[model samples]
Target: MKKKLSLLVLSLILLLSTSSSIFASPSGFTESELDTIFEKAGTPQELINQMDYYTKLFIVENSGEDFEFSSNSTSLYKFDSTLDTFIEVKETDIQPLGYIPSTDMSLSMYTFNVTVNGVAMKEIYSQFEWLNKPKDFPAGIGKDNLGIALPGGYEIQSGRYACAVQTKLEKNDAWGAASSSRCTNQSPVVNNLYGAVWEFSASQNYLNIYYKGTVKLTARTVSSNPVKRAVSRYSQARENALGNYGVSIGIGAASISYTPKSGSNDTMDADTNW
Candidate 1:
């Protein structure tokens, strides 16, 4: 009986040890498997070239006072020629391939700043409603104002407001939008003015490669009475005719835009390879 008990305990210990060894690495892949991926990639640069990533930005009104932007998530994918579709690469798998995670590389360090008519405005960070909900937005379509909630009490005056995102990377590298949307409405009614007007610019880097592409969304308000009417007419006419606005951000096949009503479901990719 004593021998049988000892053998059972030894078997349990061995099983636990095996399980730990199998899952010890952050990635579930074993060292041998990672080596195989590296071998298949051919070169380190090619391994990076095989991967593509994108970030999502959602701009929504906060408690009818100010706008809130959420960029808490990013998705990475690797092109599989055989599958003919991009397969998602887990966050844990990024470092194993000798590349920094997208979140760490850009998203985590992003800084958001607001501006009114070219003058910087203050940004207040607090617990927002959308933060609790899922961050999913449609990839490339437009929707109505059903879920949108804009601020109120500014119907008398029109202004151009913007919320821009920026990130400082290694080796004095910085990337962000040059400008944002120039059209916005102060009334609580969702306006037909929906679009993204920003250019993402990046400085050249010789030492290390960083993400050179960017996607940004911002809110704007036009205050002058005459300009407001003109904007309203232009926006309505465009919305009624085209139904959507497509703005190209001229970076490695990346383009982003908004819709006629909701302006929430837009996404773009920033390729890491040169």
Candidate 2:
């Protein structure tokens, strides 16, 4: 009887241990792993507070997907010695917008079209050029043109429509300088881009809807630090048939004006997304 009771107690202990191991976390992360992540993210409320605007937007856009963390050969997290913890690395792509400039770094341009609610929204023209002793050329500049088009016969609900354009210069994935422009019905001109004219459809159906603007970034020397220029264009329509809808496109162009040292600029690749 004593031997039988001892066997029963051992089996129960093993069963309980197995159950606890199986129910550690929904993401299949062990308790110790979860503790490390939480420690890096700080308190629960702190982690929530640290979420930025873009992060929230991403969550809303991908609400149907389950969020999980996995470590492997292609894991996004990397150990940081300064913080003594792991940090997630976000990789951005500029392929969706259009062609990326080659290493030769000549002039390149692409046009991207956006459609919302079965209606054509606008066209974005992104261009980058290397100024070889052009009159008063500092280093390089980013030029963008936005052309707005609204299909006829389709009645657009009266709502606010806004467009924003941004250009950023970065070196080694670090931001250097930026310029932006925004236009709306209430404010026809926010920032002027090379004296470009902005036009809107003369129809009452669409209260405030038009996309016309130009954005230019100040040039920076790239003799030592090879940099990349990223141009982003975004348009938003609020209270439309599909509720609030927004479309954004971006492109990145590499600058090779100055010859780079062997293997020194290997990590200067450009990756941009909007």
Candidate 3:
């Protein structure tokens, strides 16, 4: 009886060890299998991120009175292949706008101070509603109804930094006339009612806006007024994508406008997967 029990124990131990060794082996993905995956993973969006890094940089040219980017929310991320995460590289809600480009030459400067309508200037918020939100804006907003005043003593680039503004349009009856002419042909990918605007300016600096095509502004207010507007760049992108993989940052550069409101979207790259 004792000998039979010993044999049973040894057989069980051997069976467990063999099972573990089978899983521990590299059969699932040998060097050859990994090569196949690398060869098969050829997609356009992946190519763009590899080639250009596709990161768009926009400095907060105007810091009007309103919401500010929360400390935990402001971040820069780079996609990590091994971990499949957008690793945060730099983050700061308090970082002031820097690398402000001159309106005349679009030349980026390193240091400067900016004010709006005599106010010393705070952070840029896309709209007043974001300040009232329970969570505040998950994403930082843009500033409007203000002029960027660069105190002459400081250089332009020192105070500049890049940020992304998410925008949404409330296509109510009021936008009827302008929407037809400006947005009728918008790509189905963009909400058409929303777009992102990236601008750069310094204290008393000039800004020139160029529309890809000639845009006839029926009313100056129609283009400049910040009404029925909200910033939700990622939100709109997600919505437009439906349930598909959706867009991640570094996909491509989004084309934008400068009139404070109502911009069109353009494809930065042909590859949607990016």
Best by lDDT: 1
Q: Tens-digit lDDT track for model 3 on 55-103?
A: 1111111221121222112222223448853344333423222211112
What is the TM-score ranking, best to worst?
1, 2, 3
TM-scores for every candidate against the unseen true structure: 0.22, 0.20, 0.16
- Tens-digit lDDT string for candidate 1 (125-243): 11111111111222111111111111221121123233222222343442322222211221222222332232222222311332232222233333432121100000111122333
Q: Give the TM-score of candidate 1.
A: 0.22
lDDT of 2 by residue, 111-224 (tens): 222334544322222222221211111111111122222112212222222223222222212111111332333222322221121211122332222221232121212234
- In angstroms, give how far residue 101 of model 2 lies from its true place: 9.0
Ranking by lDDT: 1, 2, 3
In candidate 1, position 208 carries an lDDT of 30
Better of 1 and 3 by lDDT: 1
Steric clash count of candidate 3: 26
After superposition, candidate 3 runs with Cα above 4 Å error = 1-72, 91-184, 190-207, 210-274
